[model samples]
Target chain A: MYNLIMKDVKLGVPFIFFLFPVLMGALMLIPGWIYFIVLLYFCWITVPNLFNQFKAQNDLMFTSMMPVTKRNMVKARVLVIVGLELLHILIAAIFGVFTMLLYPNLTYLFFPPNIGFWGLGMMMFAIFNIIFIPIFYKTAYKFGWALFFSVMAAMLFAGIAQWVGIQHPVVNDIFYGTGAEQVALQAIILVTGIVIFAAFSIIAYRLAFRRFLRVEV
Target chain B: MLALDVRNVSKSFPNFQLRNVSFQLEQGYIMGFIGANGAGKTTTIKSILNMTRLDSGEVHILGKSMAAHEIELKQEIGYAMGGVDFYTRSKMKTLTDVVKRFYANWDDKTYRNYMRAFKLDENKKIAELSTGMKVKYNLAIALSHGAKLLILDEPTSGLDPVARDELLDIFQGLVADGEISILFSTHITSDLEKCADFITFIANGQIIRSGEKEEFKESYLLLNGAENQLNQVKDRLISYKINSFGFTGLIQADDFDPSCGIKAATPSLEEIMVYFAKKEDQYV
Candidate 1:
């Protein structure tokens, strides 16, 4: 499984894919653009583009000839997706911190570079994974439909989180209120997001495996 | 013991279906699967490798069921697809290094030797190589892994005649060890004529005939009759093509009599394949 993941990471992707993330991570410097980084991260490590590389060289058929099982192939692929997503998040988070340090007194318009926003990011990715994986696994090569459904899911998660925070004063206070109350809410949301990320990704993995069993290469 | 066994296998798609396809290859022999363009040869190969899901039936490789022992069986079998599709954008040496990690017994020496023998440059990107070179590179990888059962689909399609003969000789040498077995599917009957011990012919997604090469040929006799004489024995001929000059085809040996002005000659593998591929219901 490690080999499979490395094959796609090292050989499947080009050199540019590695360097492009640094540029996206830099977006955190722009106060208003900070919110855009979350969506930009998805663009940087797009699942559809990753699949385009695979389809371009017929990599699935080539790798399927190796001594790996179909189940493990799906698992390794999901692991690669998760690994890339985490890499993007880690880099973006670092830059986000740097921006916070660089502008300690600046007024923020959107969700501040706070723990709660990161928690929201986690939930957004969880939704993306849950939607993208099992649907893409149904027909390993078709990227358009997977992109449509998964992006819709990520958008839905982000829109709802943002809207609910504004519509109700109490719900808004937990996430936006000062000091201890915000910290506690951030911790709770973060914990829940972590749990969902782990649980939803696992469910995605098993479901993708089952769907891929019916896939013909 | 049989190296590969496919029994009662069936698979269906919107436009194609392979029905009750069955054949077996022994421990040490080259079984050439001959078929026309859309004759389900690749599908059968995919089934044996479990690359495609089957609607019904079973494939056993090395005496273990493919369903229960796919990973283990895959380790023993080396499959080269109908067309070679490696990471063409990457250098061969780098890609080979990555692929080497998948198998426990990949031999660097054997791989290097094959690369040298096939005249494949390690530094060249796969896309830079010609189609023939791609096939050779694919074969080098398959053979380098110490695979006991080699399954190649149209491995010789892109090679020149000289290169095709060289690969055929290599397959013959591999089977001489009495341990390694090879099952390759190809439309090039001449390749099998030189090295294949067994031939299985498929037409329209059905197994037309299969057996030892000699026995497969023995079932049909090549018939050559003049255009005028063709009509006399036309009903007896299994399949015939009447060109402007003369007519020739295949007929079951038992159905032909020398006294009927029908000349019978021993058929080559190509002759047998051609007759079967062109067989029509009206002639039957």
Candidate 2:
């Protein structure tokens, strides 16, 4: 399983993908910017290209030939996706901390890149995974429709979460404020996001495996 | 012991279906899987490997159920399709590094030997290799994993005749130890004629015959006679073609009557396939 994950990283993903997190993370340095887009770049750019690379490379056929089960193949792929999503969020969060330090008194017009925002980013990726993985495995070789639907779902989650963080006073205060209690609430949200991410990814793996079994490849 | 057994396996797609495809390869022999294109050769191979979910029936590899022990059995089974078409941009060395990790018995020394024997340069990307080299590269990896059964699909389709013959020789050498068994699918029956000990012919998603190579050919007789005698044996022929010289057709040996005085000759593998295809065409 570890080897499959590594194979995905080394062969399936291009070198540009590694730089995407860092490149997109730097956008978080723009003080008070819409923070979700930093992570959304993953959905917008990294994912489509990655899955396209898999298709172009005939990855399904190549991987299926190995001494790996279809189930583990899906598991390893989900791990790669989760691993990349985490990297993007973690890097963006680091830059977010720098943004906070650089503009301590800047008036924020959006959800600040606090722990809660990163939590929201994790949630967005969770939704993407739950939708994308299973759908992609339907053909296991085509990704266009899967990418379209998954990115839409992720965008919707991000949009609603950001909207509530802006309009709802309690949610806004928890996300945008810098007080100790607010930070504590943000931490709770972050933990919840982690749980949801893990749970959704697991469910995605199961569903993808079942769908892949029906695929003729 | 049988190295591979595919029994009553079936799968259906919108356009094609494999109907109870059954074949078996004994240990340490090359079994040629011959068919016209779209004859379910690839589908049958995929079913045996469990790459495609079987609609019914089961595949056994080395005396164990394939569905129940896929990963474990796959470790002993090496499957390659045509050539190294995937990861074409990746260098052969990088591809090998990734592939070798999946097998516990992967021998780096053996891999290096095959690479050298095949004249494959590790630094070169897969796309840089020609078709024959691409197939040789795939074989290098398949052979290095200590695989007991090698299932290759159309491994020689694009190769020049000399290269194909070279590949057949390598296949013969692989099975010389009485351990490795190979079941390779190809329409190029001449390659199999040189190396395959057993033959399984598929047409229209069905196994028409499976047996020793000589017996497979010997079961059918190619009869040619004057146009005047055509009606006397028309029903007995599997399919027949007429020309200025007369009529030539394939018929089961049991159906041939020696008293008819028609000339009967042993048909080559290619002739058998052509006659089977003609039979299919005539029915259609």
Candidate 3:
């Protein structure tokens, strides 16, 4: 199962590389601090697409034929999602740091373009993963449209967050202000995001394992 | 001891339902699961593997309930599907590596031997292999796992005659050990006639008949006679059909009366299957 997850990750690298220029261009439009959020959106959308392909390949049937249990299958897929999420963060963080150094004077609207941004990005990814993975795992082809709509809804929520960040003065000061207080706030959000991601991933795993147990090949 | 015992097993879906399906396959025996297209052959296999949740009934493999000991039961069973789907980009070596990590008893020597016998290129991606080669690959994987019971669903659907014969030979060789049992589902009855020890017929999601191969052969007689002669034997017939040439009916092969001047011929498995499939409509 770990091998299977690695295979998915290897298969996804090409797509991620192909999206580099577009993702870099999108980053130029946003403040360096919030670039991580956009990167999170990219990871959220692309990882599921890769997993959708994996599911459609009928790996479940083949894997189930092995001595492995259905519970192991569900665990492998969830691990793959989490692994890909981390890879996305690592790559985006590298590019973000490069952008920050290249344009030092450019003002960041939120936390600095460093670990703080990656933290927020992880939080956003966690929210999407928790909601979407279990749903897709349950009714893959059947609830495909539902998963699509849910992804779109996540993107919409991200858009709203950006909008609110720009409009509200107090919200803007707390998030975009350049000080230790702002760093502390970002730290809290990052920790909360990790906690949420861990909690939801576990829940999703249990639901998906039980649901797939009943699904006919 | 029986290798598999499915006792009073029934599964229901919205459109189709399998009712009271029961059969037993003993060790060292090959039981052919014969059915038409949508006869629930795949469904029954899935239920036994615990791939699909069964509403009622129990499936026991090697004296253990599948529900209670699924992992242990599956470890001893090998399965191949009618339509095999693999990761197109991965090569056979990669697949072997991945599968080898999971099964403790995977025989690498047998795997290598099968690769050489089948002439399967280890470096070539699975998507590039022909359908026949894909089936061969599936067979190799199923066989190399040291499995005690083999369950195949339509394992010989699209192969040419030569390839089909080769597969049947492989199955025959595997059963020569006299400890392995096989339950294969196929629409092609000729294959069963060649290698099967027992035959089980299913139609309309029901087990119509199941018994030893020779017993099944002796139970039904395929008679060809003139229209009037067929009419004379109609009262004793289980099923009959009228065509432009004459009338043909299935009657008790043993009880067939030659006094009526109607010829009683030994029926092949195919003819027996057609007789049962046709008999259902007449009886219902």
Candidate 4:
């Protein structure tokens, strides 16, 4: 299983994709930017290209030929996806801190990059996983429709969360404020988001594994 | 001990179906799996490996049921599906480095030796290799893993005659120690005639015959005679093609009548397949 994950990273994913998170993370330097688009870049560029590479390289057949179970194959792939998602989030989060330090007084029309904000990002990626992994496994080859639906679903989550942060007075206070009480609430949201991400990802893995078993390749 | 056993295996697609496909290859022998295109050759291979969910029946490898012990059995079974080059953008060494770790008995020295012997450059990307070279690279990997059974599908396709002959010689050498068993599937029967000890013939998703190569050939008789005698033996000829001189046809050895006055000779594997293929067409 470890070997399979390594194969996905070393062969299935191109070197440029590893650098995408850093390049996209630089978007954090933009003072008071719509931070969600930074993460959306991953969905827009990396996910489609990565899946396309796997399809072009005949990854399903290659991995199937190995002495591994279909279940493990799905697990390894999910781990790789989750790993990349986390990388993108972490890199952008670091840049988010630099933005905060560089312009502490600069404040906001949108949901600022805060603990609560990252929690929302996590949930958005969770939604993408829940939708993308299962739909893509339906064929385990063609991913265009899966990518389309997943990116839309993730962006919708991001948009709704951002809208609520702006429109709801209490929600806006918690996201925009820096009080100790607000910080504590933001920490709780982050934890909740992580839990949801883990749960959704596991569900996605199970669904994808089941679909892959039925696939002819 | 049987190296591979497939019993009553069947799979159904929307357009085609495998009907009670059954064959077995004993240890240390090469069995040629000959079939025309879309005859369920790839499907049957997929079923044996449990890559395709079987609608019915079972496959056993090395005396163990594939359903119960697929991963364990796969350790000893090396499979290469022809023409499918995986991870084409990746270098050969990069792919090998990842694959070798999966097997417990993977020998790096053996792998290196095969890479050198096959003239495969480790730095060359898979897409850069020609079709024949791709086959060789597949074989090199299949051999390096200490596999006891090799199931290769059309490994000889698209190769020049010399390259094909070289591959056949390599196959023969692999089984010379009477340890490795090969189930080679191809439409090219001439390669099998040179190396295969047994033959399993399939057509239109059914197993036509499976036995010793000589018995498989000798089972049918090729007949040639004057065009006038065609009427008497028209029913017996499995299929016949008319020519300028007279007509030639394929008939079961048991169905051939010496008193009918037609010259009878044992058919080659190609002749047998051609006749069986013609069986589907309207007799001319």
Q: lDDT: which candidate is best?
A: 4
Query: What C-alpha lDDT, on a 0 to 100 scale, does residue A112 get in candidate 1?
Result: 65
True contacts kept of each: 0.90, 0.79, 0.62, 0.81
Candidate 1, A28: how far from true, in Å? 0.9
lDDT of 4 at A103: 89
Candidate 3 clashing pairs, residues 3+ apart or interchain = none
- Per-residue C-alpha lDDT of model 2 across residues B1-284, encoded as one tens digit per residue: 99999899988899998999888999999999999988889889888878788889889999999989988888898877785489999999999999999998999999999999999889999889988888788788878988999988999989998888888889899999999999989999999889999999999999999999999999999999999899999988999999999999999999999899999999999999999999999877
Residue lDDT tens for model 2, A61-167:
89988888777888899899999999998889899999989998998888887898888888899999999889999998788889899999998888898889889
Docking class of 1: high
Clashing pairs in 4: none
Report the candidate with higher lDDT, 2 versus 3.
2
In angstroms and one decimal each, the interface RMSD of every candidate reads: 1.0, 0.8, 2.5, 0.9
Least well predicted 10-residue stretch by lDDT in candidate 3 chain A: A6-15
Worst lDDT window (10 residues) for model 4 chain A? A107-116
Q: What lDDT tens digits, residue by residue, belong to model 3 across residues A156-197? A: 656676667768877667566658887787777667767876
Kindly list the per-residue Cα lDDT of model 3 for residues B15-45, writing each as its tens digit. Answer: 9998898999999889999987888898888
| Candidate 1 wrong stretches, greater than 4 Å | A34-37, A43-45, B226-232, B244-246, B281-284
lDDT of 4 at B279: 91
Chain B, TM-score, each prediction?
A: 0.91, 0.98, 0.92, 0.97
lDDT, candidates in the order shown: 0.82, 0.90, 0.75, 0.91
Q: Which regions of candidate 3 deviate over 4 angstroms?
A: A1-37, A40-45, A108-117, A141-143, B233-236, B252-261, B280-284
Error of model 2, residue B190, in angstroms: 1.3
Better of 3 and 4 by lDDT: 4
Interface DockQ of each model: 0.81, 0.80, 0.54, 0.83
